[model samples]
Target: MPISLDKVQSTAPGLVDLAKTAKVSLEKRNLFGTRAKVAVVMDYSGSMTREYREGRVQRLTERILALATQLDDDGAIDFFVFDSTAAHLGEVPLDNYAGAVDRLTQGRRMGTTDYAGAFRVVRDHFGFAPPKLAGGEKKGLFGRKKKVEGAVDVALPDNLRPASEPVFAIFLTDGAPNSKPQAVQALIEVSTAPIFWKFLSIGRESFDFLQQLDDLEQRVIDNADYKPIGSIDALSDEQLIDALLDEYGEYVTEAKRLGMLA
Candidate 1:
């Protein structure tokens, strides 16, 4: 469900500033030309009810979609919502903004946050899960399976191939994750993969766990960063974009240095 030009013929009236801000910041940091896959993960806990009700999340989606429309040829974004568990809402085309947010708010069933579950959903959706061997397939001589010699590589379907593209996951939350240990481990595990997480915190709660993401040791690469944007009502487009991209430049440079990007 890629966003077609007709679906996003015009920007939301209130999101003009955000659209402008996103375009400028993304271009300045060279993110627009990176050709990365984009996904948005929203926190669907009870704490986020207020923000969602006030249309803050909707506006934020519009802003991000603006960036996706410019950067991605398909103009689509993989959208997910998470609380106790994570679920993919579906691809959000530019025209379906309101409907997508409505579905997220009305269909949420969990009341706690689990960042690990959210990450897992994204990994599975993108087919990044480790390949599993078939059951009862015993290895014969020289550690090779019966008649098969050497390692057998399975090719993924075309749709799944996008999983290999560098991913920029935008995680929106209001507080610290309930599953901190699992969440931290997930971040570490995905550090070597082609995914970078950008966490945006809403409200005034202390995201102590998120703040420590950059300092996590022994990671193959620093793949996550966080910013606490107190309230959506007070956020100007410039402020929002600035907060979201605060560490993006450094992340890109590191990814390139690691040969994760061309």
Candidate 2:
């Protein structure tokens, strides 16, 4: 259905409900309207130092960072930079994250890979509709949620409903998570929305992991694409920022369409 063109003004009893009303008018195409919340999870492990391409080899980190800079998110961005653990480096309007992609890349690395742990941390901030959940089932961030009465009557589209809310995520990592397999499994099973992973093979990312994710494609949404730059020697400083922004903008647009997000 076409979104309502009129401004969706409201003083609803709940923020989520207000967002639902506003979403009706934001059915813009290709990210033309407002976007919802999005988080970019970057892996800063030492393994990212591997160089890829020919001659002037560039590290996966730099190449990935370049793509992040090109995508424009005039909305809000939850940018998290992680190593053994994760931290919300900055939260800002979309432009702020785009502008700061360079500064974020300059962060010192501790050379650790805790893929599972980092995901657990990122999951704390946002909520996504769980996959395979009936169009009615809902989940909050970190498995915290209270079932609603008559939720089945909400009438959300299958793709736009609780299982497909736009609270999307991009996991940009060099290798597999050092954390327990079970931990990652639990997060994946219960996350609020489809988790779109963007893998960057910085240094020997476990081939097994990639295959494992591929296997999960049916069970979960494997939106996590890969950018294998190998190492930093190949990418110029300029190229690094461009790549990151380009992809980041795409994530922002997708998030806005689902009511699960802002």
Candidate 3:
């Protein structure tokens, strides 16, 4: 995935005159596409019962349900609840989230938290386009034999992905940890794809677990050879998750339009 300065200059000759343009091309090789399969992980332990620090106590699961409802033909979404064990929130070929949320709501739930259990179940399920790495330096999305730096929906390893499509892992946690490194290492074995582990701090008291949570964050970032892209905070169920999902959807749609998702 080494940069081809000459190719960039040729593709975008107009930018060749810019300073340092030869060092790094502006053809935008860092783009994503629509075919991504998304996995949503939630913490459903007894500790998560408190308000999400932002004053949202009652019907807390409803907020997450609302986020799930936003997912549809856009991509594959697997909802999971983690406690002393991990439970699949819905059946496979699970397309719409609204119904899935309802079904999960009906399922009895209660227990101590086990982050490792969740990782064991869903980590390996994702099929992220491996970022191109050469001699260890990351290039961009890993997929497809054709080398188009801007191609977002690049193919992925069939053994790792659903069939060379866009893939993602979204982990929602109260940032509480029973076993730190072990839980994450297990997840690495479960799924070697790009995972966006979001540590959603559940309540004011939950903030005490931030360091443990940060350690887990570093675990993924350090192993993946990249930085984590989320934070722990008083939960604010202000449709932010939905907004981000929508943003991703828009990007995929646009990428598809530009032939990035193909």
RMSD of each: 9.5, 12.9, 15.0
lDDT of candidate 2?
A: 0.43
Cα displacement (Å) at residue 201, model 3: 2.4
> After best superposition, candidate 2 residue 139: deviation in angstroms?
20
Least well predicted 10-residue stretch by lDDT in candidate 2: 5-14
The TM-score obtained by model 3 is: 0.48
Whole-model lDDT values for every prediction: 0.66, 0.43, 0.41
TM-score per prediction, in order, is 0.77, 0.48, 0.48
Candidate 3 lDDT over 17-41, as tens digits, reads 3312211221122222123445556
**lDDT for each residue of candidate 1 in 1-262, tens digit (9 for 90 to 100):** 2233344456344444455566678778776555667889999888888777778887777777776664565656888888888888887775566556777556556589988888778877776643322233332211222131232322222232223256778999887788677776666556555677888887768577786665564344566777777776567767777777777667667667655555
Off by over 4 Å in 1: 1-17, 129-164
lDDT of 2 at 73: 32
Please give the TM-score that candidate 1 achieves against the real structure.
Answer: 0.77
Off by over 4 Å in 3: 1-33, 50-76, 91-102, 124-163, 205-262
Clashes of each: 0, 39, 6
Task: For residues 1-262, write the lDDT of model 2, one tens digit per residue.
Answer: 2122221112112122323432332322233343234556666666544321131221232223222222223234566777767777765332232335446546566668766566656655654333443443334321223232322212223555533234335556656666545434634553334455555454534455654443342222223434554554444444443332234334444444544334
Best by TM-score: 1
